[model samples]
Target: LAKTTQPISMDSYEGQEVNITCSHNNIATNDYITWYQQFPSQGPRFIIQGYKTKVTNEVASLFIPADRKSSTLSLPRVSLSDTAVYYCLVGDALANQAGTALIFGKGTTLSVSS
Candidate 1:
């Protein structure tokens, strides 16, 4: 995966919007980003953030700029249960081609309060 930088922590309240960004300066032209949300004692949730496709799910929306060097995961009206560590990793498409496993670095912790 390409080197990425994300905020160490963020805060939000219920009914408020939350946006977490990640920066990957050296990303390839064809690279795709896959986001993951992990809560304590639970596995990471998958979110496909592709450059070609616009993905908008009930949980969140993934936005990538034209340069593909940065991305933001937008969570609309989150609740307390939404608190988790969000991660963005580059080269997910590459991993699928090579059958490689995912390696997650320290992600941004989102704390949602009432």
Candidate 2:
């Protein structure tokens, strides 16, 4: 398993941008970071992946440095409803059709307010 680290919590206001950073010190070269958002009593929803320099989706944008040791999840214009627990999981990016093992961190709780 990879050694991952993240903040315990974060605070943001409505319509503001929020960025959560995760660090994976033992990440492999082929490993990519996948961000997930989980609301209370809900399952995790995929945000984006940082396989290369960056990856973006409708939900969020992920940025990865060249060393692939860490990733940042950026959420633009967040609202109160956007408050949730975010997770970063690292896994093999080349294992397209194979079952890959993911290394999960504790998670970061994001609090959004109006």
Candidate 3:
């Protein structure tokens, strides 16, 4: 597991694009970058995941550089309803070591307003 560093908060208006970047300088080669979004009183939802290069889905896009030391999550045309806390996680699923659980850090809060 590698530690992630992200902003504490961010502000955006409706229909705006928001990009939240996370840094994992000590990331291992086996680790993959995963992003999750959580709204108030709800469990975190998986947004996207990637190893290297770009990966996009209906909800968001993940961009990882060649070094794989960092990743950026892009949310296009966000709306007020898109406001939530975003988490960036790194782990190796194949490791299968004991006590291997998803470790969560203080996520970046995105505030989408009108």
Candidate 4:
């Protein structure tokens, strides 16, 4: 697994668009960028994932540059309920061969206010 770099914390208001960037300078060719959100005392949930281009879902969008060294998770019209710890993970797509356990780095704490 590759290490990621992201902001320690962020502040936003309701109905605002939030973009959190994660950098993985040593990303491997077989690795994919995945984003997860974790609330207090809860497990992390998958948000979005991408390899080289843009991947969008109902909840958010993932943008990956050509170099694949970094990625950004974009959340639209976020509300107070959206506040959580966002993690950017890099790993292989194959579940069994990926690893024994999922490892996460210090995530970005997003605080959405009114």
Candidate 5:
């Protein structure tokens, strides 16, 4: 299993962009690194996923290094509403696997201000 690590917190102003990076040194071949964003009371929402390259969506872009040891999540033009906890999950790619659980650690808290 790949053990993941990330920053504890970040500070950003409204309308600014933010990027959070995560490290997973022992990532397995069957494992995928996923990024999720969570607000104060809501569940973490899937942001992006990648194996060994870059993946982008309407909300964020995930950049994986060639070694697959780390990844970065880019958030464009963050706002006050974007302030939340960001988590990086590393596990099996199979979503339906009953044995797989999204183990979340203390996420990076992005504090967006005016």
Candidate 6:
């Protein structure tokens, strides 16, 4: 499995945009970069994903560099309610693979203030 590294925390005011970057230098060719957002006690929610270039949705945008070693999640006009932990996952796209369970570590915590 590829190892991911992200920031421990970030601060943003309401209506401001926030961007979190994560690094996975040893990502496999078949793996994809996925981002998840988690509130205090709830499970993480899927944010965005990308193989290369860029992928965007209503929630956020994912930017992948040419080397595919790192990715970024950009949230637009965040609110106080957006305070949460952000996670970056780099793994096989197949759901039924030998190692399917996503291994998590300390994630980046975003603090949205008014």
| Model 1 misplaced regions, further than 4 Å | 95-98
Q: List, residue by residue over 1-114, the lDDT tens digit for candidate 2.
A: 567788989999999999999998898777778888889999888778767798888888888888888889999999999999999888776776776655557799999988
Candidates, ranked, TM-score: 3, 4, 6, 5, 1, 2
The digit string of per-residue lDDT tens for model 1 on 1-114 reads 689999999999999999898899999876788899999999998965667445787788988887888888899889999899999888757546658677788999999988
lDDT of each: 0.85, 0.85, 0.94, 0.92, 0.89, 0.89
Q: Highest TM-score: give the candidate number.
A: 3
Give lDDT for model 4. 0.92
Model 3 residue runs over 4 Å out of place are 97-100
Name the runs in model 2 displaced over 4 angstroms.
Answer: 93-98, 101-103
- At residue 101, give the lDDT of candidate 2: 58
Per-candidate TM vs. native? 0.90, 0.89, 0.95, 0.93, 0.92, 0.93
lDDT value for model 3: 0.94
* Tens digits of per-residue lDDT for model 6, 1-114: 789999999999999989899999999998888888899889888888889999999989998999988888999999998899999988888855676787776889999999
Best by lDDT: 3
Q: How accurate locally is residue 52 in candidate 3, as Cα lDDT from 0 to 100?
A: 95
Window of ten residues with lowest summed lDDT in model 1: 47-56
Q: Report lDDT (Cα) of residue 108, candidate 4.
A: 98
Residue 35, model 1: Cα distance from true site in angstroms: 0.4
Q: For model 1, how many clashes?
A: 0
